[model samples]
Target chain A: MELVELLKTVELFEGLTQAQLQRLAEISEPARYDKDTVIFEQGQQGDRLYIVGSGEVVVRVGEDPRSARTQVYLGRGQIFGEMALLDGGPRSATTVCSRNGTQVYGVSREAFTNLCKSDTAIGYVVMRNMAHDLSFKLRHHNLTLV
Target chain B: MIYKVSYVVSGGRHPGAIMNEYERPQLGDRVEIGDKVFEVTEVLEMTPPRGDFQYLHVTVRLVDENENP
Candidate 1:
């Protein structure tokens, strides 16, 4: 996918102009994965944060059975692993390809951190949005348990 | 110099675990994770190993830009 087009589709750049989008696009690393492949595993070191450009992926937490779990099915333009990206921590969950997929953008922890520090507007927007999304997920999980 | 720092690692659960595992702080030093800043308040000499690595114990205080000792 074209860099400009990909950036427009991501939530983090929702309000940015095309020129700003292009600048953000230049920093991403595009990658592809097949169905059932593990993008990241729980307890492993985390470095790359991903955004889906095509197809679906699943995020599963905990162990093989009897573990707390959730299935997050992501479509094009969705992002994952933000918590790991923001903090230097182990993967809190495992992400796997639910279908053969292609993701156009993935960023390293150092680059993500540097961008947050250097661009206050962008940093505020990203952090605010993520906090909302995480709260929403917590609410959803609570609903599921009820 | 490489120093040991242990700040308030987590508020709960995963945050707590990650902080417990990686943070080792020493007095007079500071660390920043995301937008949060933590300072080392006390240093304790203790070694704990993970795989092939050795670690120290430290106590820290989470501080803001305006916080003073």
Candidate 2:
């Protein structure tokens, strides 16, 4: 899929216009990871958000890094590390490349912040979408605990 | 068409995922999700297909660990 098209599918960029998605595509960097690669460690500071472009990655949340438990598997169009970008806090989970040749588009928080300041619309829409994502995850988590 | 399947486990310990798959998932199919394997029990169409993407909500049950292992 085209880069801008993929960006449009991302939940965070759901309501963005074509021009806005094009602007985001301009700042996104492509990254590739091999199988079993640790994309980010839990508690690590993250400055960029990743959208899975191809293949898959896993999110592991627990005290032990080697914990077999995996919280979520992210595939094409799924974004991770957005919470860190929004809250400026350490990563709440570790992300690993579970499939070989996993690819992602990385958007730096600094770049996104600048874009948001320039175009308030992008910021507003994405922030709202992020809220929806957080709510969905929280509900799923609470349901799991029940 | 790439179907974006969100496999939610029904009364299971493992979390499900949103994945891009070429083939559609069917009920009673045992698939590995997260670190554990599960059997698909139900499939719901959350949204109709848009362009090349289709979204599906799948409910899966954990297969007996001993049976799968």
Candidate 3:
């Protein structure tokens, strides 16, 4: 599906208009990957965020660098490791090809910024979506605290 | 405020890596020489690199940020 259409389906972007989604699509680009490739390493500087188009990728989290444990698998249309792009910090996780192969769509920090500058609404929507997702996950995990 | 960028090269050097962070990309990051459009997708702070002149590395995915296809 087209990126705009894909956005419509994603809950995070559910409320965005087609025009906004199209504009977002225009600013971003597509790419492919092979099996066992290191998409990004921990502590490595990063700028762009990614959306998985095909295949699966693993999200390795933790500060230990060496003994870091992976959290989960990301499938098609699912985004991973974008928080680093939004929040100016080292990559929070190391993303690697989980399957024999993996593919994803990425947006550079600059591109996303430019797009946001041109249209703050888009940026707000994206950030809000990301925050919402994080909040939900945190709340769900917080259930253990109680 | 800093900026970042990611590009796609049908055939070029430094083509596959995803740009997850960087200070900002120069014009080269946005405009490709030929048969390519190295579009910038984000803007971030300029972080210092750990080692040498080559400080930070950019991130990009197989699919473009604006991937509509």
> Which candidate leads in TM-score?
2
| Model 2 CA deviation exceeding 4 Å by range | A143-146, B1-5, B20-39, B44-56, B62-69
lDDT of 2 by residue, B1-69 (tens): 666677787775767777666678888887776456788898877566655556677788888878743
lDDT of 1 by residue, A1-146 (tens): 68787655455555566765665676788888887788888888888778777665667788662574544455465577877877879889888776665453687877766776877676676677567446544543333333
Clash count list over all predictions: 7, 0, 41
Compute the lDDT of residue A31 as modeled in candidate 1.
84
TM-score of every model? 0.60, 0.80, 0.60
* Native-referenced Cα lDDT, model 3: 0.57
Give me the displacement of residue B15 in model 2, in angstroms. Answer: 2.1
- Candidate 3 segments exceeding 4 Å error: A62-66, A139-146, B1-69
Per-residue lDDT value at A65 in model 3 = 54
Query: Candidate 1 residues B1-69, lDDT tens each?
Result: 122122233232212001122233446777543234666565554434322223334444567689764
Collision pairs in model 1? B4-B24, B4-B25, B4-B26, B5-B24, B5-B25, B6-B24, B6-B25
lDDT of 3 by residue, A1-146 (tens): 77776555444454578898888778667877776687998888988888876676766677675787645445555576677887889887788875565667788989889888988998887888777556533432232133
Arrange candidates, best lDDT first: 2, 1, 3
